[model samples]
Target: MTADPLRIGILNLMHDKVDTQLRFTKVLSEGPYNVDVQYFYPQTHYTSRPVPDLVQKISQPLDLKQVATMDAFIITGAPIEQLTFEEITYLDEIHQLIDVLVANNIPQLYVCWGAMAAANYLYDIPKFQLPEKIFGVFHNYLRAQDPLLKGLPDGFLAPHARYAELDIDKIMEDSRLVINAVTKNNFLFSFRAREKNQYFLFSHLEYGKDALLKEYLRERNANPGVEYIKPQNYFRDPLHMKDPEFSWETTQRVFFDNWLHSVADHIATQQFVKE
Candidate 1:
């Protein structure tokens, strides 16, 4: 008999719910575990607005009372990088969710802005704002060995589009957090807290090939005066903006697959101990 599908809770802070859902499904599909996703949104930020039909299925209010118990969890990036963690619309609610994840020892993947928030709220790690957005597919090197990045090449490209930096020194010194990957510029690429069963990625590995281009165009159109450099090592031609390499697709798939497998192993181990 087939094993029951893993229930994955996604604390989706992104505004574009449909696009985010698509990227998540595309990546999770690569792993062997079948997933039942229940979307959670902060009520203050999203309110009672009706979600599209596609989102309606998986979406639910981020109610602390419901307290979703999941096999794994994923927190999507938000555009609230400029604001302080406490300044976010639903302050206590988000923290409550994070607290639950920690208290329950749930395995979690925090991406981009979500990673920054996790670092801040969990460990009191501060973020530094960059002069300009670090928008591109950057070359990242392996900092240490970990299951999530095991099969990846020595160095590979990961997409980033953020305007702030996490305190690298603090994370490095923390005995609990393992720095698995870092960029040449000292940007924290990925880190996992084994004891807490949490993973953090500052880059958006689930981004589609055209995702960066769309971001560039949106920024340029919105603020004509603002200088928006095209994402580095991304476009086929800077002028034409054709042909993205999609170099990170496989890495993205395998990363999530590793997490799923790890969660499965942890559950099995617990079951064995009980039996």
Candidate 2:
């Protein structure tokens, strides 16, 4: 008999709600297993302004009961990295969601700032502001082996577009955490706490070919007077650059394929024990 579809919940926290959802769905659909993807947003996120029509149409309120039904969960990064963690309005709800997911032993993936938030909240590792943003495709080397990195190469490229860096030393020191990948500059690329069934990825492996270019152009257009640097290792010709080389397509596909497989394996194990 065929198995049930894997239920995946994405807690959408990005400003570009539609585009963020598209990026995740595009990568996830390429996997072998059948998946039911749902989008959710923090209930406290829209207290000041009305919810956007597109967000309202695409997502539902982040109810804890609904979150418990998912086989796995993903929390996307937000643009509020500069703000103190306590200053974030929806953090209490996020913490509660994390509690529920942890209580249920559900697999969770936290991306970029979401990862930073998790590290801060769960492990007390803080994120530090950098002098300049790390806004480009960077090389990451495998630091340790895990099922999630099954098909990934020893060295691979992924996109990093953030202004803050997590405390690498603190993460490395944590006995419960496993450091999987890191850049030559010591930036933590990926890590996990196997006991908690939680994973963290600092780079944007799901970004589209022109994702960085579009962000660059939009930022420059919004601030015409400020000098902005083009994303490093992105353009074929720096002088006449319009498009980015989609070098990480293979990495993106294999990583998500491995992740889905991992989740499927977990589900099968649970079913076998119950039977």
Top-lDDT candidate index? 2
- Looking at model 1, which ten-residue stretch has the lowest summed lDDT? 46-55
Listed in order, each prediction's TM-score against the native is: 0.92, 0.96
**Model 1 misses residue 94 by how many Å?**
1.2
What tens digits encode model 2's per-residue C-alpha lDDT throughout 1-275?
A: 12888899999998678889999998888689888899999988788989878888999989899899899999999878878888899998999988898898899999988999988889999889988888888888998988888877777888888888888889889999989998878787899995778999899887899988877887898899998877988887767885569988888988899899888888888889999
Which residue runs does candidate 2 get wrong by more than 4 Å? Answer: none
* Deviation of model 1 at 256, angstroms: 1.3
Worst 10 residues of 2 by lDDT: 235-244
- Please state every model's RMSD to the true fold in angstroms: 2.2, 1.4
Flag regions of model 1 displaced more than 4 Å: 46-58
Which candidate number would show the highest TM-score if scored against the true structure?
2
